[model samples]
Target chain A: MNDPIEILLVEDNSSDAKLTIRALKEKNLCNNLVHLTDGVQALDFLFGRGTYADRQIENKPKIILLDLNMPKVGGLEVLKEIRSDHKTQFIPVVVMTSSREERDIIESYKLGVNSYIVKPVGFDNFFKAVSELGLYWLLLNQPPKL
Target chain B: METLSIEHSISPNFTKKDIEILKMYFELSKKYNPVISEALTADLADHPLWGPLMKQQTPEQRKAQNERSLAMQHAAIYEGKWEEYSKDLLAQGVMYAQMNISYSDWYELIKMYKDYLLPYIKKDFADSAEKAILYLEGLSKFIDFAMYGIAEAYFAEKNRLIQANEERFRAIFYNSMDHMTLIDRNARIILVNRIPSHYNKADVIGKSILGFQTAENVETVKKAVHSVFEQKESSVFDTAHLAGENKLYYSSSISPIYSENGEVNAAVIISRDLSLQKEAEEEVKELNRSLEIKVEERTKELRDVVKELESFSYSISHDLRSPLRAINGFTHILKDSYADGNEEALDAMDEIINNTQRMGHLIDDLLEFSRLGRAELKKVTVDMRVLVETVIQELTRVPSERKIDITLQQMEKVTGDQNLLKQVLVNIIDNALKYTSKKEHTLIEIGSYADGGNIICYVKDNGAGFDMAYYGKLFGVFQRLHSASEYEGTGVGLALVQKIITKHSGKVWAEGRVGMGATFYFSLPKPRK
Candidate 1:
């Protein structure tokens, strides 16, 4: 089977997504990645529907990078949606957001997010977080598979 | 007639001088013109007893002849001596007067006649005219004796006059209007002018006052008496005389009446009744007690109402948020899914979202204000100097060139809730920044002091001060001195700050002049926590 797509980044902001993908690639951690901007596109990519209908389900990412405060379904709803499905429930997802509210942190955890992080305010910190996250999840990640 | 019967029966008991004095009284009474003229007719008609003697003698001689001379001759023969004859007659006459008069008047009359007539009678009766005069004197003596009997009647009338006057005085003394009495230092009444029937006629005059009082009243009377004596003053007690079972009285006063030496000789007590005054006082006390109970009950009811209001606000706030959050969260979904890439439409929707967030803030502020009503005040010592610094840091908003330079003065430690005080600082500082948006520069300050036991902290800002007309709206919920368009706020920041400060047992107020910026002040206790 084709190598399962790696690093499925669910982000709505095109500039932030481009900057994130560039940062991950600069670290040589991007391979066979799939990016979807909204909950509809994200669901389709995961379930192999429409254009991705013929896509193999076993070729799935080891972990998902989720962005909250997005269009359509935000990160928390997306986290819940993934956790409820038997096929995707075992996949690890990390939530990142601009809000530092404690409520958001607890809810993300409650929805089975593997980790939660605040979106850094400055460009340098954002670049460093993407580099670190990419190297950990795409390279050295020890995710469970069945 | 009664005397004649007694005399006829007892003539031997009367002596010679008694008869002689009796004859003289008869002779003297007739000599008075009224008696002489009346007896002349009776004589002219000639009484049968004196007619033979009267024919043998001169008429004046017969009228005044020897009834007394015969009685003296008889007394002389009885005594057996002529020299002591008059003395023996006088002694015998005194004895006869005692037996005849029975009381003092007749004896006095006998003595009076003997003193004048005894010597003359004792002298010679041997002269011839004496024999004829003496024989006629017996007839005169009989008339004189009858006049002395009439004099005794007049004496009895004079004694009656003295007794009548004494009875009048006795009536006035026993029935005087005032409770007049003569009392000794021992409080014994020597004389009580009232209630004479209370005493035996003779006993009350010298008896103690106790005789008038029953056993129960004695102790009460004694208490008054002891006070008078101890104070060495005459006292008057107006008190109830509990002589009978149902008796009740109110005493007005006890006053000491003094003698010249200031020693208490007597106490005259006058007691009045008090049932009316006692009843009135009891009525007033009852009214006061009932009024207090009513006030207490009213206060409890009011407290319960306030608690209910707080609970209602709480539930309203909590329940309102659930739906509000759903609206906001779903709006996010719509904004993400349906915005048609039109920048203007997206921006308008963002504005709607921001307004909803502000509405949420307003609801939260309302909840806080009402919650303050139910929350108890908790006081703690707070150092405003460090507190203001921390607040400014949290509210700094990553300080840009638009930052405010708020100079802070050293503040004294004050007793208040620390978290609540921090909110007050944040609200005031943020308000300064919001108001000074149009200004080239912004400034604010914080400080405190010991104003009596209270520490007065103040925040001063150079900002767009509001009109004085809106002063009443300063601390009210959703009240903004300026319009929302002029200043972007939910108009709830100051209200929340005020609520927080109030819950800490502190007071907050503001002062401002148009165009001159504003100063907010609060006073909290500086007592040890």
Candidate 2:
């Protein structure tokens, strides 16, 4: 197992998360993809608190895939906290969600999201979108040295 | 008669010395006659009532009248004959009546006679002051008797004149064109003149006025009559009557009549009918009320229809699309996992996915079309040139390989909702670009001009033009002249354009020739100067 998470995916839907992980694996990009079902656990992992208190803070993921609609501690609130704190400000956060509403897109960009992607209905399109995004953020895109 | 005259003398106890003084007084009067005569004649000539006639007399006749008045005053002072003075004033009163002089003018003339004699009497009796006092006392008494006689004659003449004038006024009052009624305090009609053909004097007179008027009028009349009696003042009110099918209106005035003690005893009510005027007014009021009710009903109906449309739109957005997206997603998954090895199964899955996707797009477009109707217009001055350029730039973003020639002419500024007009331009220009994709060198033109008192805007395209015979279906939702294979469209674009144009109080139309080209035109009213 990897020592630190390379990617953290915060999504409430199980099928959507499985499909996303499958796409990244097909591209051989998921060496260490940490999937959390809701925003609370995702925040716990990122800030090294709650269930993830034993983990080190410096082992933050290279990128976060956040879904806007969730049961507790929604994606926007998590993004706002990540941006305000100096420890996680530079982490490349991308919004990946099923909502294609203009208001949601605008709010994600306003919160300094690195990229926004609308989940396509067809599996083929979804697979292509997730894989391309994974390849771009993990491989081609540069992150600050940790 | 001569003894009676002597017995009626002003002073029978006159001494010989007093008689000599009187003879000298007459001589002194003659001496100052020229000086006193002009002032006396000028005063009478300028009198308000008798001036015109007196001014017409010759100077000699005026002097003679003045001399005659002075002689009469001299005889009254010398003999104390007040009766002769009274007789002279009576003769003057007769002359005053014949000349149509006013009572005020007669009084003023008598005062002038005394003024002319005062200085002459003073100068004549300067030697014997005691004789002067006696003569002046006798002169004042004689003038007082003359005044009493003048008053008696003047009033008799005044009464005769007033009687003649009263006869004329009576004729006018009784035969006036308008109906006049006099009612007592009990709301009883006491006198009614110029009665209509259907009403006799006996029918209206001594009857309760409340019977002739409507209930509302009766209340108004009662209030007006009560106020008149309480305040001892006059008040007017309008009342209406129904004579079979005809409606008669009248304006009645209530005035108080006071008895000998100066206390109000009764009221006089005068009514003037205004049925024609009142009928016209009532008709107009009824018309206005009915029109207002009609407008209110129409507005309610329109609101109900709008509410229904809004709910329908809400269901389409929330309920229909979620299931469609699920079907499309699951079908695509099936095609990828199990059906990939079977070409027929894969094809069937692809068909389901495509149909659902089309349905989703159609729903979105329909929702937008409905929203446009309900959207509040935020009007601003829109530059059509910038709007067109922006829409074209957006449409050409993907970079089509087909050579496209786009021309933008001089466009006018229009006042409309910026977002809505932007949508209108986008839909139209987008159609132009989509249809012309098959052409080798497609030409699209955008321009505007002033026509028919409005700013006319148009988009022309060298694209797939349809038969004019199918023009009726041009802007109908889901309507299509061509099949999906020939040209792809949900058929809501033109209908949306029509709706948006209609909302702006503008008009939209199209002209086309099959296989040649088509142009869509819309007009907006120019901003008021």
Candidate 3:
């Protein structure tokens, strides 16, 4: 857990979160991954607030996989907070959610999201999408140094 | 013999010598006045001018006229009141003229009196011939003076009548409501009824009308004026003037004024102000523009609401699929991890997986059905025959040993969205194939014909037909007459076909009888020639 977090997954549904994590683990990209259930916990972990206060704030994740629909603070608001701050603006934020609504896609891109993906209904397609996105963000895409 | 001058003058002057002779004649005429008056009054009854008039009078009227005649003669000769006698004669002349008496008739009556008096003058002075001539000349001069007085009265009365008529025309010319101007062929203002508020009467009287007109209207006004003069006809035109900040409109009508001998002279132009009407028309235009803007705004609002509803349905389906995916994924893992060698657990897991898959298919169909409503239609002329054949070829591409027969009748071309029309044909013919699969020999016929302004196409199949009692629910969303176990269907095929057809301004209907057969009909608008 102390090794620098490489992937940050933000999802409101627990089952969806577990499935996404499992897919990443199958690809062996889940070694340094952190899963937050909602947008509030994701924001707290990123800014080192609340239960994450004692953690090192300078330790940044390689990519943040965000979901759009969440309770008590949504993913778009979290993305807005992340992109607006100079300290975390360089983090690559990938929006992966079940919503194929055009508004959500446009808003996420307008907030400077690195990539957007619509989670497929079939488990095979969903597993493949998550695994490829994790492998690309963690292995292929070069993130700016914080 | 001294002859008197008989000049037709309104006012005649007499010499002193004529007065002396008239004095001598007056003394001689005094003795014979009674005889002359009586004889003249009796002769007046048969006179051409006075005969009918005197005949209608009573004897008392004749007696009064005789007495009046004697009194007038006595006033002239014996009393020497010639001034009074001349005044009375002149007054009577004016009265007669006012009563419409012909001047010839009045002159003839005067001559009758002179003829009667001449004989008496000659009889009184028969011994001295020179004296008789002198007295006769004086009497003639006296009668000429009296006639001169009557003639003067006639001319004065005529002049007064002409003056009255001139006054009447002047009143009308000066007191008109419209701005009436008299212009010559050169478009110069000769006379105007009302002067413009900005110009003096003196300044406008002789000025060229083009000077007063605005630049835009000068040519039009000049042309109208010249046309009226040349064509000898009236012309009307419109003109606009910018009066400071306000724009004034006027309509001028120019009519030719003919002079004597039928020559076109000056033209009179009457200009009426039309600014108020122009302003009213502008206001109506502004109102229409605002109304159009309001209608456009309302249409935009309605479009936004429709867009919102579409996105709402799209997101709901997507969200629903998310949970189903998780359930399927978790169940697959559970069956592999914990249900090994356990028949009951494996069967339950398989059931869960199958139902979840089914639900996923339903949601996908529902989303697609909703998307059809918002898709922009791309209309083109589509050949129905080619489209049906292609659909049939594709549906029957999979080789099977079962005997299958498909008959495609003649179909005319129609105008619609090509892809949507293809979708409609595929759905209907596929239903035919699916329902008729249970039969040993499958018979599916697709045909079309021109029905009024539309091309009606129908698919007939000898397959599992539904009861006619549920015909009302044929094209409704998710309304299926058959059980899913008997026929694997999402029940959205017919509804999708209905939506597409309705969007093309067409209709969809079906007829069926249980165990007999079923026919599905759809109509599309004919392409414009």
Candidate 4:
């Protein structure tokens, strides 16, 4: 409880995921974090299934940093599972990805993602988007206690 | 000595001898028409019926004689002696020979009098000497009167028939519709009616016409003559003359005209000009070709107008969305940061933000859909099995505690625009998650199979399903089957899914019951090898 998981980042692009984590850490928001590179591994961590089966299931993060493009079960699938179950459905989830495709944004909100973020191609815009998303989801927003 | 012998054998009285000679003449002259030997008029020229009378009758007696001959033929006068009859008949024969009276003329005169006199003679003079004597005398006079007239008419008619035939032939030769020239076997123009009469006619008629023809035409004309005259084979040839008004395109064929003995007498050359008709037809063909070009130009102009209209719609959707998106983004920020202790206000503001976000999504979707319509598909064989799994992974990147049991049933890799297919899957799975949010547990499945060379994939969810009544609202831009309060949505997710799938030459649709779950299915063609 002292170091509550503030951000749970799931993405597959090493460069993009690293850049996002770095931007969030620069703002001192990445200390309480759990990062998964793919949807299957991310799913396992959330439900304590597969490799994360030994971990406690009751540990809920304050905000999840989601990337839309990833291998195996992706950001959208993770969002669906989060919103479907009574235990995890109330946790705040934000979609963050390099793709700005219209469907990606609409689907994120439809699945009850608290916010949708598009990773910018340019260095300055990428920094600003990551910093803003981390601040809004982790420090500013209040989380519902389960 | 011969005179004495002939005299001893003859009659002594000159009057009696003359009478005997006339009788012999009369006997022969009674047989008329020497061709058919039908007697019509009895004695002609030397008949005693006229000449002896002419020798006796004064100028004053001539009318009376003509009257009596007419009167006897009419049966009004009948006076004649047997000896006079005999003498008249014999005398007519000699006179007929002297006049050179042909049987044809004698035949005509006899036919004329047959209708007038023959019936009366047959009825009244059948058997008696007196009647016979009357018949002979009447016929002799008729023959004498008719002979000179008939002989002159015959000669005149014969000459006229010959002249008429010559004139008819001359007319055809001079005014023939086809251009004709008569040439001897020597290739000389013996006669040329249509050609200029003064055109060296004397030289051309006897000498070879090859000297007068154009240098090029001379060889052609000679070849034509050899073929048409010597070889006796007819041929047609086209000749081009680009000179002045006399210029003609002549198609001529010559045939040898033969004599009765089958010797080639002359070659008849026939030619006709078709230059004007051919020129008119060529002009019509040129006009039609130009008209076709004009039609094609007009069609291209219409296609350009259609393209302009399509781009106009795309721009409108894009420009209109930016401000609406700002309204949505700012409203959410206000609710989060500044609505302290005002629960109802926060709730109201959340609702407003939600609607604005929905509107923003609608605008973006409409623009994207329009863009896809024009975008050229970049086709590639994406490992779609791995691709869908990756999309599913991205969707689940949010909260860590929710349990999503994803059964990927025999997924197959497919060919498509990789990016578009990923977007399509993301939208569909995300939609299922939104509907199933209230469920105690959620079950989602991503599976694929093949149908008739197309790869079909399904995303199924055990969730709160929409009623069949509102199914029409599915996959339409900004048309939501579920309320925002129940499970939040921009209503454009399925529509965007469908568009992306369609852009990849695929199709998307869904099936569900009200309280059961929904399943989205899409199909795409395998890439051509």
Could you say which candidate leads in DockQ?
Answer: 3
lDDT of 2 by residue, B1-529 (tens): 0011112222234456655655555566567777876777677676566567767888888778777777776766666654666666655554555456767777776677678888777777789889787676555544455666665555555565567678876786687756666667777877766666777778888888788877677788778877877788888777788676677777777778788899876776666667766678899999999999999999999989987887667656645655665677667667777885898898888889888878877888887887777788887778888988898898889976889999999899888887889889989998888888788999999999998668999999999877899999999998988887788889999999999999999999999988788999999877656
Ranking by TM-score: 3, 2, 4, 1
Can you tell me which runs of candidate 4 are displaced by over 4 Å?
Answer: A1-146, B1-307, B325-348, B380-382, B412-415, B496-508, B527-529
Proportion of native contacts found in each model? 0.00, 0.18, 0.61, 0.00
Instruction: Provide the TM-score of chain A alone for each candidate, in the order shown.
Output: 0.91, 0.95, 0.96, 0.92
lDDT of 2 by residue, A1-146 (tens): 34777899998776677778878988998888889988899888888889988878888888899887777898999999999889999999989876655567898889899999877655667789989988888889998775
Candidate 1 per-residue lDDT, tens place, B133-162, comes to 653465345434433443334344334444
Better of 1 and 4 by TM-score: 4
Candidate 2 vs. true structure, TM-score: 0.55
State chain A's TM-score for model 3: 0.96
Model 3 residue runs over 4 Å out of place are: A1-6, A36-95, A101-117, A128-146, B1-267, B340-346, B389-412, B440-443, B447-453, B527-529
lDDT minimum window of 10 residues, candidate 4 chain B: B1-10
- Per-residue lDDT, model 4, residue B524, is 88
Q: B239 in model 3: Cα distance from truth in Å? A: 7.9
Give each prediction's DockQ, rounded to 2 decimals: 0.02, 0.13, 0.37, 0.02
Per-residue lDDT of model 3, residues B296-395, tens digit only: 9999999899978876786676679888988998987898778878999999988888788888878877877888988989999999999988998999
How far off is residue B298 in model 2, in Å? 20
Interface RMSDs of the predictions, in order, are 11.6, 3.8, 1.7, 10.3
Q: In candidate 3, what are the lDDT values of residues A75-138, reduced to their tens digit? A: 9999999999898999999998877666789999999999999887777788899999988989
